[model samples]
Target chain A: MSLISVGEIQAAAQRIRPYVLCTPLIPAPWGDRDRPLFLKPEGLQSVGAFKVRGAFNAIGRLDAATRARGVVAYSSGNHAQAVACAAARFGIVAHIVMPRETPQVKIEATRAHGAEVVLCEPGRREAVAAEVVERTGGVLIPPFDHPDVIAGQGTIGLEIAEDLPEVASVIVPVSGGGLASGIGTAIRALAPAATVFGAEPELAADTAASLAAGHRVDWSIEDRNRTIADGLRSQPSALTFAHLRQVLDGVITVSENEIRDAVREIALRANLVAEPSGAVALAAYRRGATPPGPTVVIVSGGNVELGMLAQILTG
Target chain B: MSLISVGEIQAAAQRIRPYVLCTPLIPAPWGDRDRPLFLKPEGLQSVGAFKVRGAFNAIGRLDAATRARGVVAYSSGNHAQAVACAAARFGIVAHIVMPRETPQVKIEATRAHGAEVVLCEPGRREAVAAEVVERTGGVLIPPFDHPDVIAGQGTIGLEIAEDLPEVASVIVPVSGGGLASGIGTAIRALAPAATVFGAEPELAADTAASLAAGHRVDWSIEDRNRTIADGLRSQPSALTFAHLRQVLDGVITVSENEIRDAVREIALRANLVAEPSGAVALAAYRRGATPPGPTVVIVSGGNVELGMLAQILTG
Candidate 1:
């Protein structure tokens, strides 16, 4: 499989420039003195996640007529909101298929962006989304499988490289692997000396298992759903797995307790709220998995529910 | 009394470029749709507050010979940490005087920045700081009284104007008024049409009272200390009062409940942790005190105690 080129990511960065924020690489002095750290807080994005980069890029890249027909996506997480928001900004309709068991707040939030939300039974979001695409003649914008989406998320890597040219290591959360793949590709091209690592909850360590086995490995949805980092439940797609194989130096699996501790520490010390999924990179860093040098951690998202955040802060 | 100039602020921005993060103005779509809100999260600073801007500017401006003699500051809050970090960066000694009653976390944070911390009785911090200056022959960097400090804080206003030239209004939390004075001055000069407002807790609304009376009003520290926004207890110094009077379009006071609500809202919706003092600007905006258009609120700091933050989040 061909990898995403630096040029594609640069183009995506340009395309998404007007729509997305250039989140600052905030200094995180609270990290180990030996391994200085900075946080690329994509949670500061308007949609509260890095998903917007891919969503906007994918939607923005569509031909005028196809884009006018709108787009379709399936997710009960940040991707739903990202596509909805991206489509709304482009004045195009978005049909998002979500699980019926999804929280009302999530549904309302997606709807608030003016997306047409289609509810489906659990484990049937893909079939439902396909049906919506068939009915509406809208193109499917998968959460992380497409090249446009991966290239778009890679813009963050470009930013990290540009902001800290001396960055020795980059740690990003792994889910469907689009984020790590995109960021890793950019870093490999631009900051070739920098080592790229993927972090995920040990409860859902499918990527680690796959990388260790030197091939794509599948995990049952029920098994993946065991982690508190809900965003990490999805296994990497073939495209993302290929990119991950090319770009990643290693995969670090953090315990659920470590993820919770990182979330609390990030809030109390760094003054930035991190969802469990977003906090995994910092958790890995805290566990001394990353090398001793200037490191950048992608705080991938912050769409955590308030009650969950409070529980983590106190726990 | 003279106010800080945009030219001075511009210079300070240059001097502190390498030390401080140019925090992005995060778009907070969760705010009122018609009035669009953006949060300038200064809490992302290494010291977790906007104080570093003033601290860095003040210390950076010192003559090489004089600066080599070191610096002294009195605070039990973010200012202490700001000065300590700034001094350490400049490779100069920093003697921070804190009240003996200060939480150990704050003292330890200050000392961790390589500062010599001197603890004194609650009412004697200033006197003790003066004695430190006398003994150490270090220049005193008053938290808000100095022109350089005000100019440094004003850099935030410069950034707001530059990033959002059409900004309709800018609100800042007012304590000793350096932040408001600095930001207001920049907005007044660069975005003259933009109304600059000051937000403060009703429990410590001396700035509002003073503005209403057309003179500086003094509130007893005992009365001012009643609010959870411990940062805003200090009354504005004459220098800052002059700038606030010249630049402010209005002063908005929020109740304690309102301040707490804003903190929770900002954390939950904006994914940025704001201290009660920092949240007051958002609280004031929520009350519909500002004119309609794109509004910018300075989230001045995020140094709230974790217990307090938890209580506010749960409340």
Candidate 2:
């Protein structure tokens, strides 16, 4: 297992500076008096997620020979769009394997980025992606497990440290754990005094259970799929689990109602559009799961369908 | 009538730098094929509106003795919150005169910022504000007519020119013409090659009609109030009209449906929440009013009521 270093994250920042946006750290209006909260709205990224940072960094690190061979990725959401967009920028061919049940908006967004969309049956995304890589001789870019991807995501933590050196705590939404692992690692190196907390939905709380048990834990796909945070269904890989254990102080699990309320809070108070997965960190913070201080909540993504957002907002 | 100059705008930017946010310009995902659109989301500002820029600059320009006397302002929406927030930052007393029928949310937000909210009859807000200023001996910071206010708002254009020197056109929402006048003046001075256009709802197209007739046109309050964009009901002041005539190339009037569509589009495509008034520029741009080039649209504010936003999003 290769552990990522702060130097690698710093290098990744420099490499992907031109490709990714340095998303603004917006002050949350309803922050507690004792702990002023700021939102790192990665939803404002070009691909509408932090996945762009990792995608660009991983693709940019490829040698000339590998770059010519192109890339293959599997994602039902933001990662697909990120890989497709980053590949387009490099003028490399990309094959994105997505589940056939994925939202039309996500599928269309991926295709719009000039990637060949290969729809596979549910739970066959990984197999389809492997096949594409084998047949096309393309480099496979896993969403959250690789060193380059983790380093790319760490760039966000680097930015937070640079922008707010006095940051006391950082709350990040955890899925396969690339975002939390990268951010936590960067914060550990750059702002060691600041604690890092991972936020997971109660319905898909494998990370919390795993962290508590001191090992990798697996939840059935049906069980993980119960949360409205569709992007956070994947279990953490061994590499990401190792990074999380080293960097995170603890994990916070939020209910479905908490996530819904957080989405509304972000839209109303922060004037930001956040998908359910993107708002989990804020949900955890609102629940007082983290210690008080100058806190930063990472709004992970904003690829929500219109109908779903409307229903949540109205409901 | 003193018109705002680029130098004054530059000075205002410095004065309010500590109080106001230098908002980021986000690239719009659904921009035209020929003209790429960027959104300057002032909604992300501390007060969730560009009004904070003018309010801060106006109050900051006051002498120490005058600042000690505190400030008074009249507004039914964003401006009230702006004055209150800026006053709190400056540690000065704020007396906000709002309409009796003002939304409870706006009223609460103003009070929450530590301002004394004085409610008055809808059309008598100015009279109530004048009385408050007379009684408390507070300096009056009118929303848009004052030179200091216009100069402060002009800072947006300065930032736009600095960030996107290749910008060819600017689309600004025209409510009382303050935003348009200020932005137009700055763009005219800083980026002379760029053309400035004002966007207004067809129901309240007083600015468009005024510009076409070469004078400030009057629209009855009832007629103007028929539009969903409540912030745009006010007609342009004589001072603002003079500036608009000198700076604006044209005005675009959009339908009510178009404004609603723009609100949804900003939320769905750009992943940013925008009020109906703030979304007029994009609505006009969508209607093909601006020429093909790199265009910047000022998303003036994002203080939309949650229920209204839900209706717009769902509808």
Candidate 3:
């Protein structure tokens, strides 16, 4: 399979410019002084996640007839809202399949975007989404497996390189690995000297295991679901795994407690809210495992349930 | 007194570009449908407030000898941190006088920036700051009273107009009126059709009352001290009041409950943390008093105590 090109990522950046926010690189003076830190707060994007970039790019690239027929997607949280929101912006119908166990806040937000939400039993979202695509005659926008989606998310890496050309290291949260694949590809093409690291919850460290074993690896759904970072439950597909293998310098697995602490720290210190999944990169960075000069951490999403956030902040 | 000129604001914007973050205008899809809403999150600034703009501009413009002599400032919260951060960047001494009743977090943040913090009685901060300046032979940088500071804060207005040219209304939280004055000047000059409104807590609505009476009016410190918005207690100075009279379209007062609710709403919906004072403009927007159009609300700062933020979120 051909990897996404820098040209495709640049094109996606232009296409999605009107649809998504170019979130600023927030400087963290309180961060590790020797390393220096800048947070690429993709959480500030519309729908409160970087998922909008990929969703909009995928939907926007579709021919008018296909786009008019609508789009389908499956996600535990942020991507569902992204596709729903992107579909709404295009004034097209969207059918979103979400896991029944997904946070109520995510489900409601997807519905709020005027998408038709279909909730299936745990571990059955993809199958349910495939059925929806067949019934509705809509194109399925896979959360991470598609090239357009990867190129769209790659725009973030393009932005970080543009804004902070001297960035020595880049850390990104890895779940299905699309985000890291896209960003790592861009960083490799644009800032080859900069190290790209994937951050994962220890409970869902399939990527770390896969990278070490030199092959794709999958943890049981039961094991992945143990992480509070609900978004990182999915394992990488063959295509994304290939891209990750080529682009990533290393993978850092963080504990559940560290993820929770990073969320609280982001809210208190950076004055930005990050869901547990989104805080994984910061958690990894805090562990001091990466070579840091001027580092950038991708704060990927903030679609967390407020009650859960309050609980985390309290603790 | 001569009001802040747009040219001066432009100069300040250029001068402070290297020091401050150019916060993006965040789109709010869930906001008032008819008017549409965008947030200017100054809370993401390096010092966690818009105060850094003025602080950097003020210090950056000083001659080498004067700057080397050090700087003195009195602020209840955000401005102290801003001055300290800016001074530290310039490798100069910063002596900050804060009220004894100020939040411990603010005091600690100021000290963390390597500034010398002096605690003063509630009403004696100015006098105390003056003494520090006298003793140290340092130049006093009064929070919002000086021209450079006002012009620096006005950079936000320049950014808004550049990003959203059709902005019909702009609201900012009012404390000493420098922010409103500066932004109002920029809006008047650049986006002339845009209405500028000041948002204040009803408990500390000195600007509202003063606007109604056609002159600067003072509310007793005891009365102004009743609001949870510690940053909005200061009244407008003569210079800032003059600018306010010329540039303001109106003033909106929100109750204390409304201020608290807006803070929670910002955190929940916008995925950005805002202190009570920072949320005042948003609170005023939610009151449904402003004319419906494309509205921009400045989220001024996010220096809330984590415990207080947790409590507010729990509500």
lDDT of 1 by residue, B126-235 (tens): 99998999999999999999999999999999899999999999989999999999999899889999999999889999999999999998898878988888888889
lDDT of 1: 0.91
Candidate 2, position A95, lDDT: 97
Best by DockQ: 3
Error of 2 at B120 (Å): 1.8
Residue B60 lDDT, candidate 2, scale 0-100: 92
Tell me which of candidates 1 and 2 scores higher on TM-score: 2
| Chain A of model 2 scored by TM-score | 0.99
Arrange candidates, best TM-score first. 3, 2, 1
Q: Model 1: residues >4 Å from true position, as ranges?
A: A101-105
User: Pick by TM-score: which candidate is best?
Assistant: 3
Collision count of model 2: 0
Model 2: per-residue lDDT, tens digit, B89-165? 89999999999877787898899999999999979999999999989999999999899999999999999999999
The per-residue C-alpha lDDT of model 1 at residue A65 equals 91
- For candidate 3, the TM-score is 0.99
TM-score of each: 0.98, 0.98, 0.99
Chain B TM-score by candidate, in order shown: 0.98, 0.98, 0.99
Q: Give the clashing pairs for model 3.
A: none
Please list the residue runs of candidate 2 whose C-alpha ends up more than 4 Å from where it truly belongs after superposition.
Answer: none
